[model samples]
Target: MARSSTEAEYRGMAHAREIANNPVQHDRTKHVEVDRHVIKEKLDVKLVDIPLVKIQEQLADVLTQAVSASRFQDSLDKLGSGDIYAPT
Candidate 1:
């Protein structure tokens, strides 16, 4: 049976933290299935980190929707990004 998204997120959080800290064990996490190995490999190679951001502070919306000018600049500042073609 498939787990719900919330359940899967919580479950993955627990197992990922543990799996990330220990050496890879192909047979160690059989209970959680095999997908975790992909995350573990990424962690092993320093490809990413999971950081929690508040919903209001999420910047991805800037890319997906229209935002006010100030809000757009705020998001850009938060990301340390800027427009290169603006008048100097």
Candidate 2:
């Protein structure tokens, strides 16, 4: 049931066109400007199909190491810090 790359790209273009035509929130004006530029630049670009892989299969060890290192650093930084401990 998966769509071909060309079909998916067509759908993505249609969705982008819809968003470009309808500017929603005031804060989105800047984003819409960027999207407009991107759309114009990519108007004639061909779609390339990139193979997809499961997250666990692709990034299991790498992500695990990154998350573990981040958590370790965060825990180290949180230990024992207070103005009350200053010499008075």
Q: Candidate 2 — what's its lDDT?
A: 0.54
- When summed lDDT is taken over every stretch of 10 residues in candidate 2, the lowest stretch is 56-65
Model 1, 23-74: lDDT tens digits are 6653576666566777888878989787788866879657756678888899
For model 1, which pairs clash?
Answer: none
Model 1 lDDT, residue 8, Cα? 60
Judged by whole-model lDDT over C-alpha atoms, candidate 1 comes out at: 0.73
Any runs in candidate 1 off by more than 4 Å, and if so which?
A: 1-52, 86-88
Q: Name the candidate that leads on lDDT.
A: 1
**Which residue pairs clash in candidate 2?**
none
**Best-fitting candidate, scored by TM-score:** 1
- Candidate 2 lDDT, tens digit per residue, 1-88? 2145456668867776777677573346567678867776666473433468754343333323444655544544455333566698
